[model samples]
Target: MNVADKNLARVGSDELAANSPDTRTRHGKLVSPVITLAHGGGGKAMRDLIDDVFIEAFSNPTLNTLEDQARFQLSDLARYGDRLAMTTDSYVIDPIFFPGGDIGKLAICGTVNDLAVGGATPLYLTCAMIIEEGMQVSTLRQIVKSMADTAKAAGVFIVTGDTKVVGRSSCDKIFINTAGIGVIHQDFKLGADKAQDGDHILVNGYLGDHGAAILNARGDMHLTSPIESDCAPLHELIQTLLTAAPNTRFIRDATRGGIASVLNEIAAASKCAIEIHETKTPIRQEVKGFCEILGLDPLYLANEGKLVAVVPANESQAALSAMRDHPLGKYSADIGSVLPGGRAGRVHMQTSFGGKRIVDMLVGEQLPRIC
Candidate 1:
């Protein structure tokens, strides 16, 4: 078997024993072995499916009530911070299961990172799923379990959800949508328009691993490598950076379109020019080779666990130190700087070959359905 297949096989073997057929019962009802149209018909089959798969895996007081909506106490939210931050994201990645993570884990981390980059402490999330009829019950159970573990690690709760089943052709095997709510401290203020001249640009670690891993997992190119998705929660890393450099001008997660698109957006919003040094940008050798072979630019490839920070020149060292000290930011680097307003709304890169080039927004989709 190829590397991607081998990796998936290993994951299945490791988890299948615990998730066998004998373990598929809840409330004295044996859950259906496979999803059918009846599971989405809003009747006993639907309730039983929800109870056995979702509610069972994500058990908490708020979610257990089985109410139409989840309610939160304002007083409890006020303890974390004064401002609230909320974000929602959908995951429709091909090959629902991939190296290092699956669609379920991606949904949680993507939403959590969105709130984190906005200077918020993520508190809760809502999960909604659209499943294709005929998908295996065992597959749904595995994905839901992965979501539960990721939510617990991020210190957030999944308190509400909705499930819909459609004809097999209407959707892929499954799709996940997650919305997150967080609280931000009154002292923290950040936005893309806040970037200023002389602000140093920093990235937490290597980029494009998630995109590369997903592409390889599809096996379209018949290629293989040890690259795994860099899918992870960045709230702690952001919190640490904020503590060390309170004057950080802006922070953004490098997701779709990678760091290139993020820099272009920041430049346009702030009316400033961003200049990055090619030599300083960190990229895995395997990803670089893969991109080279495919005629792809790593800069435009997506990343899940990376963030770009714009901090004042004076505080750059402190921010770098704080990032490097964290487990996720050990490979952090100051890749570039926000320059004066002469070339407003532009992103330029200093190529390693001693030349400069404009890094503009992508003209079209480089990879579609890549989450």
Candidate 2:
């Protein structure tokens, strides 16, 4: 039988067996054999699987609710007067190791930046790893060590973790998923919708360095450039900026979908037009050449150590100065501003020659499976 047919047949057989009166415990509850994909699919099968596995393991009221998200009350003393922020990310960057940093570093930095952009001071993280069979233990050690270093640099702790192993062919060499929790200052309120017309958009640094650096590291294309990934922790840079501009509205790290996608999202969320000046947006010459030769748009490319900030015009310069003084934001610039004209929720690029064009989200996938 075909794989699909075989799976269906087994599922049918299991369902019949599960419903049979004989398939019950002494307590008279139906029993299941093991976990399956249906367990995560949120159907009758999922309910049974959860009752059999997860609830049986943890058996907590918070987890039993099975709502879209778990909510709980935190003590005001624990809050320390800061709002809570949480973020999660998975890293499966190829080669594991690459220019500037490795997948481990990316995993930690990626989630930390998410919390940072949410106006949270990242404090803790949980790491989960999936390793393929026959993978070298030494390599795993290296990745773990890198995670430790990255967390230390960002001033966060890895409070918990999990590890799983799969058949050699079932997974790549390794994959890392990290979830982070942070506390946002009481005065700092940032969200995509907080963006307003006349708000200036500032980027922490040049673009596309991470994506280009990974491509070069892969040896997929025959080109050489000193453009290493700008992968670094932004907690300090962000903290410095927050100190100067307590009234900042929103911030986001440009990662998977890059600056274009982020600006498009902010524009749509805030119902404003984002006008980015190509001339002012920094791009290393090598990156521009690489993108030109490879038919890539730097706008849609990923960045690791960069953030997009929308701040008041009065505080824009101070924020820029704070960003520039920080090592991670040394190349920072004021790239654009929120405009009321043009299509709402759209991003327009002012070309280097002084013309305008639309910048949109990545349609499918330009650089696939990058972090």
Clashing pairs in 2: none
> lDDT tens string, model 1, 89-110?
9999998998989999999999
Index of the highest-lDDT prediction: 1
Mark the regions of model 2 whose C-alpha exceeds 4 Å error after superposition: 1-79
Q: In candidate 1, which residue ranges exceed 4 Å CA deviation?
A: 1-28
lDDT of candidates 1 onward, in order:
0.87, 0.74
Cα deviation of 239 in candidate 1 (Å)? 0.3
lDDT digits (tens) for residues 1-371 of candidate 2: 12343244234323322322332232212243433334335566545534543234333333344444433345521443356788888888987899899998898889888887776667667776776766664566567678777876666655445556566677888888889877665777788998877889999889999999988888888676887988888877777777767778888899878899899889889888889999999999999999999999998889999888898888999999988988888999999998867578889899978788999877888897777
Best by TM-score: 1
